[model samples]
Target chain A: MNKDYLNSDIKFNKEVFKTPENYFDNVKEQIYAKTIENKDGQMQSRVALWTIVKPQLSLVASFAIIFFIALFVIDKTKEITPILGTADTSSYIYTIEEGFLKTNFIDFIDPSDSSNYREEIPQDQLAEYIKDNIDIITIALLD
Target chain B: MTDRDIIDGLMNNGNRDHLFRLIVDKFSERLYWHVRKMVVYHEDANDILQNTFIKAWRSLDSFRGESGLYTWLYRIATNESLTFLKRDKIKTFFSFTDSYKNVEDRLNADPYFSGDETQKLLYKAILSLPPKQRAVFKMRYFDDMKYEEISEVLNTSVGALKASYHHAYQKIQKIIEDSV
Candidate 1:
């Protein structure tokens, strides 16, 4: 039966709300006790948690560091190593021997004496000539 | 005691509990009303206010005094109230209940809510607003907080808060007119 109920304008008045007697005091005391208890509990839990987790974390970190170092070492080894297989290496050696025979042996024979020297030497004959002229022990040692 | 005195006392490990009692003395009532206006239930407001203080105690190390002590506490209270409302809304939704009706019933039943019919209807209108807008309106209209202070507490731009308050005012005015 308030007049404001009929009026269009309902003024904002905060005094209408109420609280229980001594609620603030009761709450203050409650908050103080609760916070103190909570602080002690929290400190204990933090210390316990760190004690449980510290070693595990350290172990994980150690493993991670070791794993990275292993990866780095393997990568460097790959860089220094040649990629050729054994068969491919022998073929490469034959190619160099053929070039050496063509340039040093065949060309060194007097070209004016065409009958004594041929345009190309067979690989077997070249191997025999190198074996007879170059000491096999000295060649192996140099290699 | 001044805020600086309280902060200095709290900074020391030995005086922290005693100083915190002073803080509770200073802010509990003001913060309780701020929360009560939002949630409209004394019990809920009580819970939120306690939570605000507890949170402040836990995070004391982080309070660098960059803002006023009351401003910081207000921010915490506002956040707790909003979170409670959102959580309560979800609970009401899942329970297949109308949150508005529930508040209205509680408002009528609560001995603490001494408002007459007109005040009750005004609260209903206020409740109809979105949570943030409700906060803005209550802080501005009831608490008479400045727009700048509200901005700090709500972390909103002053212009936006002004606009929001205007919209909230118009909406409540319309609701009252229609009821009449």
Candidate 2:
């Protein structure tokens, strides 16, 4: 409608317009400066912090564990299995005799292992002794 | 050259007066209108437009070719304009009456801003809207911006903008019907 509102019906207070030309010039200078800093040939390198802490602790811990484990693995590989049940070995008989006296035959066995009683009693001997020494059980009971 | 070529030349540190001027010539009036609708003042629009260019020029180094250059520039200008609005709102809230007084002054001075008797009812309906919804409405209708572009600028969903616009139109329609 040509019956629209009047120009006098509104007012726009104009703000001051100042050229900020200096700002652009300053920013360009700063960018150029930063670019120059990037190009400087100082072979700029930062000391690797994680590289030191990570690998060094890992090496120490790993090797310490490995040293213990190498000794373990090598010791394990060289292990004799104590010749316990071998035909020429008398250790099974020694263990049975020791068990008869209730003394540990493998007393000098690895103390670092969790348990103190390290000797493995012969199953067959144990069964036989259990059958034959029913009186030993009764004595233990009476006592 | 076009804005794209100008931006390219500027980023490469080559001659860019033609490009910059092309931008100023092609977009300045449209951008002026967009800014004017939000701020409702020619002066604030001028400040926002100048600041927008300065930012675009400075950040041209890190422009990264992510979106169209003008779209990126528009993003900055929109943020600048909204931030200005927020700051002005804080200043206006010192006396609540003063805020409406400012609006009253604008309605008295500008002719392109006229809404009829129905439009008066509509303005009241719109003024009652939350600031974000009001902004979405202004951008969608006054500036004729695409929902996708508005979404990029507002970091809102297109669905949300559409809903806000639909709600705004419905509310205006309802208010006008009531006036009759």
Q: Please tell me which predicted candidate would have the highest TM-score against the true structure.
A: 1
The ten-residue window of minimal lDDT in model 2 chain B covers B114-123
**lDDT tens digits, residues A1-143, model 2?**
22222122222222211223463344333433333233331321323445435656676798899799889887876655655346344655676767753443234457577773524656676676668778977898999
Candidate 2 global CA lDDT score: 0.59
CAPRI quality band, candidate 2: incorrect
Question: What fraction of the reference interface contacts is present in each model, in order?
Answer: 0.57, 0.00
Write candidate 2's Cα lDDT for B1-180 as tens digits.
Answer: 665676677677775444554555566555655665565555566567666666555555677666776677677777877876665655455334555556656655555454544444445555545556767877776567899978988999999999998887666556545555
Off by over 4 Å in 1: A1-9, A40-143, B12-14
Candidate 1 residue-wise lDDT, A48-117, digit = tens: 4345456666888999999999999999877656554355666767888778433446446776775845
> Chain B TM-score for each model?
0.92, 0.75
- Top-scoring candidate (DockQ): 1
lDDT of 2 at B108: 51
